[model samples]
Target: MENMRSENHRGAAMEGVKLASEAAANTNRRALRDIKNILGAPHQPQAVSKRGLQEKPAAAGAKSQPSAVGHRPVTRKFAAILQQTQPANAPLAPIGSERQKRNADTAFNAPSDMECSKASDDDLDEMMTNELKEIDMEDTEEEEEEMPDIDSCDVGNSLAVVEYVDEIYSFYRRTEELSCVSPTYMAHQSDINEKMRGILIDWLIEVHYKLELLGETLFLTVNIIDRYLARENVARKKLQLVGVTAMLLACKYEEVSVPVVEDLILICDRAYSREDILDMERTIVDRLEFNMSVPTPYCFMRRFLKAAGSDKKLELLSFFLIELSLVDYKMLKFQPSMLAAAAIYTAQCTLNGCVSWSKCCELHTKYSEEQLMDCSRMMVELHRGAARGKLTGVHRKYSTFKYGCAAKSEPAAFLLDARRA
Candidate 1:
């Protein structure tokens, strides 16, 4: 009896374990259904019926006796319930056999995790290449959009762009006269002529500052002085004489009103007599052949700036070029036209902050930026050499004139006299 009771207790424990397992499986099925509903998957009653059918064989096989023998009616009732609940699309397959076949197929065909990772890497490489190709296409489209249409009306006068080349060439030819009055010519002169030249330049610069005529008048006066020197071989003693006369001529030609002979002499610190100035003036008028039609640096500067499409950049360049003129008498020998153009080009390059050769060429299509660079270098070198020791001369003369002669006069009187002078 004890052994039989022990065996019954064991059977009861196994039955309870089986019931618990079935209950857990049912809960897992319900959770899966809820997840499918949340994901918006269509209701798959046929799949559910198939899953139920798969679980049944294990339950039936656990029983040792054939259920058809002892529970025929119960078995029939179970079959009727199954038929009623089963979905129409459920496959007619023996549960254990079909599941085993499916497992075998999955083991043969499915990729391992390592294989999947390599496929992902290949997919990423392909995606990156395609993305790069799209970016290139976008860049091409943007370039096409930014390009100006040749047919547009606003592009006006294609020839204007090319015309500057000829203009630069023509200006170069016009200023060829400068090459004749080289620095060597000035260097070879006697001490007296050199001293007179120095004195003359000093007076010219003084007149320029006093008159407040700015660099334009100063440039014109210097050109007149150089041209006169080019034509006549005046002595050094007469250098002041030539300078005053040339300034008088420039004042009349370039300024609003010409300074009187008395004013010119006074500005000279009484170094020049009225009679001496008058005589020198006559000589200059005759030597120049009374043809005072001299070209100025400003004229060329304007033209070149226009050609380079940089009229807006003129003020700074003009100031620098004018200051540079003060440093070099050799610059006077350069046709006002060439120096002006060259100065403008150099100033533009400096201001725009372009360092490379190609960038400057791109900015101004007319003379190669290389040619402009060479021209600027030559001008600066010539200026530095000629300008040596000249600033002191300029300062001494201006200081004497400004303090000694003009100090007693009214500010307005001084300004007027300076202007006329």
Candidate 2:
């Protein structure tokens, strides 16, 4: 009886151990299944259709069919499942079933808020690009307007006129101080000076008659000749050569139709051969160094007339002064301003036929004529003492000019006759 009781107890104990092992295994399997479900299905996957995300069923079974006609729920659910399986950072796939799958994946996995933020950045970039394009267009237009055309060369030519005016003014100022000085101070021997001057005057007159150039140009050439001679103690024999050379230089500088070297030689009555004149021309050009810039009485006359504010009177004064300049080679040594003023004074006297001291004073003040009297007096004496034969050509030219004037006006004829007497 005791043995049978002990066997029963052993069997019961083994049975209890087997039941405990089975129960532990079942508990482990259930815990593992719960963990997998939580991690794999944390959120419901979004449905995708060919068009876009399919609308969710309003209530369970409210849309047993898809919201869109002919749209299948299984297709949308498969797309959503595929999208959910894809990695978040994967690049978009090419267009086709693969691209559709990728698009579905992007839509399902990507947050709505994140896509909205990226859209704002793309809009900002586009706006910036448009603004930069507008700025570039504006810059192009401004560049086109600012660029100058090649046809505007006339504007450059006009600007060059101011340079000429400045050059004339500078020449006037340089000779202003020498206007008052006497010719005796300028010469060592009076008798020889007189004879040489006469020869120079005669040669000048001949050239003037042949050229028929304006009086303004001739006066300028003569002034240059006298001024150069006064400054340099050149020999009396070289005086004619110097005069011709000076005239050539002046003509080249001032005249539009300049005479050639051959023409100048011929005009000098073959006194200078072509070779001789050419040699002299080279020497003068070298000495002057092409600096033939000098003011003429004509230039000063314009300035004085502008200051005086009388165009008609200025015209009359210019005619007489230019004519007188031809007769008196001494005037060449005077400053252009002094000669211009004196000529104007002389004309005024001739016109009114009276001596007005007050008017003379006003004129002197206006042109500094009183200051220039010494130079004017010296110039007058040089011409008065000049030999008569030297001025043969000059006389002929002046006679013709005077005759033309006489034909035009009684006042001019009377003035010419009075001047001869």
Candidate 3:
């Protein structure tokens, strides 16, 4: 009889253990559901694992099974944690047991942890995108605001031509296409070549300086020579005559006090007489159809200088670089406006010791530094050789104290580095 009583007591203890385990699993399922709701995830029923509890006798079956069985190990982990907070009457959980408990707790919390992490990642990405957009918008607005209104200051000056300035430049830019000569036109000339052309220009520049003529007169003279030569061939003997006659015509068109034909004769060391210059002048006017109103780089230079808000130093330096380009036949490939813009840009870089293209310059010039680069590079190259070469007329002119010795300034070497890079 005593043996039967002991077996019943053991069975009762096993039944109590099963009931306690089931109660703990139910508590964990409820806790998990509450946590999912808090994290804003859709409520999902806890699923049973493959190692689920088996059926028991009908008497045991009267007791309710937990809605979730996977949480039984997790419930034990929680009990271990809770018992640690209680008074020190209970023995401390073994280190190995504590590790297992933590592992089970982590397994139970993994799904919600991942869901929470994914949601946090999405929020962070959205925040970053919005911040970037705001920064871009701010940058665009700053660029627009920073672009200067250069014309507004000139409104009070009549010579500034604030009313018709934009229209006039638009006209010049449009007509410049007609004024451009082929850089390859030298290939078609029989008696004259590129070297001879450079020599003639170098000589003419010296004459233009000696006469105290306007800069535009020199430019127009070269224009007349190139355009006339582009259309008609001449003997090598007549090339200097062509140069002087073109200068004479340019003087008449651009100068307030035109130099007399006899004066040009005297300057050429009696090379030709009044009849030779007068005769060549008529032939050129007739050939070019008296289109003396064509725009030159000088026209664009004044405009870009004003756009740059230049001082005397910048102005002199820019002129020096352009005059250097004038001696190079290859520079004919660039348009007048392009040459002007590049000259000023190269001058700015030379004076400032860095590449400095302001927003104001780009807007008025209608060409970026990239567009001006090839021309600017050629200008810088000419600047390097200006002081050493035979065609040093320009270098001598700018080196004078009257022109602020702009030619003495060092060339912008960084631009050459950009080419190699």
Candidate 4:
């Protein structure tokens, strides 16, 4: 009986052990089921519709969109699940469908109090793009209005000018500073006299005419000579060499085909050897600091003539006056623009017998009658001197009808008196 009871006890113990093992297995299976529920069904699953891709529904009253520019934060476990679910070689989801799914996910996962419903990121992006386009269009319109329309203007006038307007204006705006030559610069000179300077200028004009060089070449030659004199002391004998060398430098800077050094030597009757000319050229250029950008009265004369409506008579008279200014040392005190304006003013009054500055003159030249009086008086004196044949080169050049002979034409005595007044 004792043996049978021991056997029953052992059998009952074995049965209890089996029941505990089963219970443990059941608990493990229940936990696995809860995990599966949390993560959604794991299987050889079909591709999900974009609308139903999320593992779980978001909490109620959550925002419906994500931030526009930045991305949402994702946890590592979620990324791992994504990596495991999608095969490495599988075709990607269509971009539109993927974006829609991401939008829905972002909206569902967003904080409830946030304003996700205001606009989707894509919608906001499109709206911002349109706003930026409108702003750019407005700016373009304003710019078009502010800047002159080069296309509509005359081709001859506008093409080159409009293309390089900014560069040209920047260059010419420094004219006063670049062209300033001290009136007293010649006071210390020993060998060079004002009469000799005038003669040199007259000869240069003749050479300019003979060579058929551009007006710019003549203007630049004169500029170089005056600037060199301002800085250097050339002996009386080397003066012609200086003039010829200055012309050569000017030709090189302004001409398409520069005059030959041999030709320049011949022009001066071989008074200067090629070596002497070249040596002086370097010396003059060095002393002037290679600042050959002096603005001449001729540059301003052209603008002033155009401002005065390009009157044939007035243009000739103004040209004659400006050229006369070039030969006179006394006229060096005035700026190039001032000389041009004064020339124009004197010419206009001589032609029209007007005492006051014309509106066109004031509008274009930006000078008042009072400001121009002194220079005008000086110009009137030069014109009279030319008329009397004292200033012969300019007088002879304008004596022809081609130049309207305005140099020979005299302003009334009252106009001369007004210049003095």
lDDT of 4 by residue, 218-276 (tens): 87888788888887887899888889899999998889988899988888887878899
- Candidate 2 lands at a TM-score of 0.46
Residue 60 lDDT, candidate 1, scale 0-100: 48
Give candidate 1's TM-score: 0.46
Which residue pairs show collisions in model 2? 83-105, 179-375, 180-375, 202-390, 205-394
> What's the lDDT of the predicted structure labeled candidate 3?
0.86
Of the candidates shown, which would achieve the greatest TM-score relative to the real structure?
A: 3
Worst 10 residues of 2 by lDDT: 405-414
* Estimated TM-score for each candidate: 0.46, 0.46, 0.66, 0.60
lDDT of 3 by residue, 81-185 (tens): 656666878655444456566765666555444456777998999999999999999999897777666789888999888988889999999999888999999
Greater TM-score among 3 and 4 belongs to 3
Q: Is candidate 2 or candidate 4 better by lDDT?
A: 4
> Model 3: clashing residue pairs?
none
Q: Which ranges of candidate 1 are over 4 A from the true structure?
A: 1-183, 193-199, 214-216, 308-314, 356-366, 378-421
User: Candidate 1's residue-wise lDDT over 1-421, tens digit each?
Assistant: 9999999999999999788779978886543344432122355554544212222233444655333323222233345566787789977753445656676456435654555677799899999999999999999988655533222332466854543545654665576464334554564545445445655675577677776664556766666677677677767667777777888887787778667899878877898798898888888889778866655666556545554555443444434444455445555444555566566655554455443233332333345555555456654343334324654434333224333321111111221232356
Can you list the residue pairs that collide in candidate 4? 64-107
lDDT of 2 at 48: 27
